[model samples]
Structure formats: structure tokens, C-alpha cells
Target: MSEKIALGNWGEELVAKKARCPKCKNAKTLKKLTQNFKCADLICDFCGFVAQVKTSSTNDINTLPNSILGAAWGPQKERMDAGIYTSLFVVLRSKSDKNYSIFFLPSELQVPEMFVAREPLSGNAKRAGWQGFLIDTTLVADRFVRLI
Candidate 1:
């Protein structure tokens, strides 16, 4: 598998093992959903809480970045229009020590202003014309709940 995929899988595994569901308070109940589920990566089987996980290797695990690249813009926009927003789990791995710090951004704190649409993919690229987004962490930095 690609390094990106492996890193993502490792981050998800860390979350599944360490993070507890805010709703149900169960750590083991969080299941990794398929990649097809664009809106979320982990789901709580007990409370039905869904969260999108973003993993990044950073120099400082204690600090959250100003921006985080997000998934497809279309589905996120659709959900935003319908007033449905998934919670976010940001997993930051220390580049030097390889320790992880997980932060949770509740769905209630998410807003359209936090999602900035990215330019569409080039025609020559696979999945041409597909667009993504970036989560503007500056907008909700103070609201994140540290889970680990």
C-alpha cells in the first residue's frame, strides 16, 4: 500500500484504540468505515456518532495547523445545505517522536465558513474535474476538544 494509505490506516487505528465516543463514551465501539463513506471515517456503533478523521504528520503535536485539507467538496456542500455536518477528528503525529495527538471538532461548531473549496483537478489527472475543500482551522481553533 501507498505510504499515504498506510499512514491514514495507522491514524485510524490509533483513534479506534484510544479515542472514546463523546456520545456513547465507548472506545471500542468506533468502527472504521469504508472509503466510499466520504462524510466520515469512524462511526460509533453504540451512539451512531460519525466523525471525519484527518491525519497529518507535524513537527509539533500540540499545535493545530491553520488549514487542513478536506475531502470532496460536493458531498460536503450537500450536507452543509441540509444542515447536516459530521464531527471532525484531527490526528497529528509528531514527526520526530511519532507520538499522536487527537483533537475533536464537534459538528455543532462546524460552519460553511470553515470549508474553502479547492480548485478542480486538471483534465489530465485521474478523477479530472473533481473538487475538494480545506478546513480553515483558524475559524474554529478555540473550539476543538483534545481527545488524547
Candidate 2:
């Protein structure tokens, strides 16, 4: 059997683990879990934060220089023992058993640095604080929040 093949560079760039988890300050433990990046330390769970999470990163989402095209959302669990905060609010979801889902911004818009949008009937609001979300703006205006 004979096969013919032809191609240049597949018009692709390798995602060479170009980033690190700001919470744990870890780079070697990054793992691509589906579309989101997960921490390799299954037990650590210090932060199951997204790896190449573009929307959350300061360089991508913050400095868009236009309407807020989009934003990343994730829930974090409390890890008080781990000496770090965790994700708990279901930001991108409804009152269901499923996990959070990603939402898109069709147009550019401005959102408050401390934006917290939630459902009207989501019971989670009572349990979790204002935004079960975290934004480490203590050091910088657009730093990532500690999530799990």
C-alpha cells in the first residue's frame, strides 16, 4: 500500500506549558484537564486552577483594551488547612447538579473589577459569600484568585 501526504507547518503552535499556577506558585505541576488546566497534585488541590486560562490571566482578560469580550469563571473549594482560600461559588451555572459552565461575551463591555453576577434563584448565594469567587487584587489589580 502507498500513501500520499503533504503539509507545511500545521498552522499550529505548541502549548508548551507556557504558564504557572499563581496560587501555589507552581509551574511543573500544570496539567491540561479538558479545556481547563488542573493542578497535578490530586491531594494538594491547593489550587485546581486553570493552566492556560486566558480569560482569568491579567495579560489576556484585563488588558483587552476594548469592551470586555469575555471572562473566565470557576468555582473553588475551601482549603483553610492548606493555608489558602478556595473556590465554592458556582459562578457559571444554575441550580443544578452539574458543574459550572463557560459563558461568552458577544460584544465588548466594561465590567467592574469586583464584578459578581449570579442567578436570581440560585440557593448557593445564601451559603457562599457575595461571590464565592476570588480575585487576588491585593498585590495587583488583575491577579488570579485562589481556586480549586
Candidate 3:
């Protein structure tokens, strides 16, 4: 098979391909999971590292320049522990009105767990104080430039 393949799901096509493992730097072990959440999950069998990509449901993608798009997380503690940061965040563009969506990628977008005070947070998330990572979009612009 080729290095990349388009997997269809829910009548939508998922562009899937192998990804590099951030932990072990293994090129072959990381592949995008086409099932489950419909986005992408970078899972590395070489080091047991896994991360998810979440697509925004909202149509209004025109966000303020260099701002956070949103936040998300897996309910399982195991996944959280495996992640570099317990919380995750997505960033917006620096300046643009176009509808550009970003994913809350792990490994690359990790934050210190302590900084996230979940106990003081209150929202729809029943998990605790704060659920997702608090990130500044400016710092992550370079990392997600391809997506932008």
C-alpha cells in the first residue's frame, strides 16, 4: 500500500497516513486510527504512545487572530496519563476570517498538568475543576502552520 490512504467514514473521507512517534521517534509504529471519533489518533505501538485529533463541530471557524479555538480531552485517566499533558487545546489563526479548524494534538501541544486547576473550574465537564489545557495560540502558530 501507499504511504497514505483515504478511509471513508460516515460518508466522509479521512485522510490517513503514518505519523512519527514523538516518544521513540519510530516512523513505522505510528498510524492514524480511522475508526472511533472520526478524526485521527496517532498511536505508536513502539512506545505505547497515543494521541487524538478532534474536529470542531461549529461552522463559525473565523476566530480572532492568534487565539485558542477550543479545548478537549478523553474521559479515561489512562489516556490522560499517557499524554504529555493531562489537558489539550486547539489554536486559531493569527489573522483571517476564513473557516480554519485545528486539532488539539498531543505530544506536540503538551502543557504542565499543575497549571490546569480543574478543581476551581466549573462547566459541562463532570471530570473536575478544569478539563482541557489553557493555551496561548501565538505560541502554537508555528506548530500548526500546515493546518492553517
Candidate 4:
């Protein structure tokens, strides 16, 4: 598997093993959903809470980045337009020591300005015309809850 995929999987596993559902506070309730699930990676089996996970390797494990890359822009835009937001779990992994941290950004703390649409892919690319978004963490930096 690709390094990106492996990193993401590792982060997901850490979340599954460590973090409990914020809504229900149930242990081991977060289950990995199918990749096809739009904008969500894990779901709370007990409380039905769904969240999106973004994993990144960084040199500074103590600090959260200014922005986190998000998945498809279409669904994100649609959800924003409808006033629907998903909870975001940001997993920061250290590049040197492989240590990691988890930060939870609740849906209630999210705003429209935080979702920045990225440019579409080039026509020659495999997923040509596909677009993504970036979650501007700077906008809600103070609102994130450190889960780990």
C-alpha cells in the first residue's frame, strides 16, 4: 500500500483504539466505515455519531497546522450550503519519532469560512476535474479539543 494510505490507516486504528465517541462517550464504538462514505471515515455504533479523519505527518507534534486537506469539495460544499457539518478528527503524526496526537473539532465549532475549495485537477490527471477542499484550522484553532 501507498505511504499515504498506510499513514491514514494507522491514524484510524489509533483513533479506534483510543478515542471514545464524544456524543455517547462509549468506548470502542467508533467503527470504520466504507471508503465510499461521503466526508466521513468512522461512525459511532452506539450513538450514530459520524466523523471525518484527516491524518498528516508533521515535525511539530505539539502544534496543529494552519490547514488540513479535506476530501471531495462537492459534498463538503453541499453540506455547508445545507448547514450540515461533520465532526473532524485531525491526527498529527511525528515524522521522526512516529508519535501522534488527536484533536477533535466538533461540528458545532465549524463554520462556512473554514471550508476552502481547492482548484480542480488537471484534465490529464487520472481523476480529472475532481475537486477537494481544505479545512482552515486557523479559523477555529481555539475550539479544537485535544483527545490524546
Q: What C-alpha lDDT values do all the predictions have?
A: 0.90, 0.27, 0.40, 0.91
What's model 4's TM-score? 0.97
Model 4's alpha-carbon lDDT is 0.91
Evaluate residue 74 in candidate 4 and report its C-alpha lDDT on the 0 to 100 scale: 100
lDDT for residue 11 in candidate 1, whole number 0-100: 84
Runs off by more than 4 Å, candidate 2: 1-16, 36-47, 50-52, 55-63, 71-148
Candidate 4: how many backbone clashes?
A: 0
lDDT of 1: 0.90
Cα RMSD to the true fold for all candidates: 1.0, 15.0, 9.0, 0.9
Better of 2 and 3 by TM-score: 3
Model 4: how far is 113 from its true place, Å? 0.6
Off-target runs (Cα >4 Å) in candidate 4 are: none
Task: Please write out the lDDT profile of model 2 over residues 80-145, one tens digit for every residue.
Answer: 223333221111222233332222121112123433334332556564433333333232323323
Q: Best to worst by lDDT, what's the order? A: 4, 1, 3, 2
lDDT tens digits by residue: candidate 3, 44-146: 6677666544333333554423433224433333444665342122322222343444444444554434223233356665755644433354655454423
Checking candidate 1 for backbone clashes, the offending pairs are: none
TM-score of each: 0.96, 0.26, 0.36, 0.97
lDDT of 1 by residue, 1-148 (tens): 9887788888888888888997889769998998768789999999888888899889999999999888899999999999999989999998899688999999999878999999999999899999999999999999998978
lDDT, model 4, position 32: 92
TM-score of 2: 0.26
Candidate 2 clash total?
Answer: 6
Put down candidate 4 lDDT per residue, 1-148, tens digits, no spaces: 8999888888887898899999999999999998668989999999899998899999997899998888899999998899999998999999999688999999999989999999999999999999998989999999999988
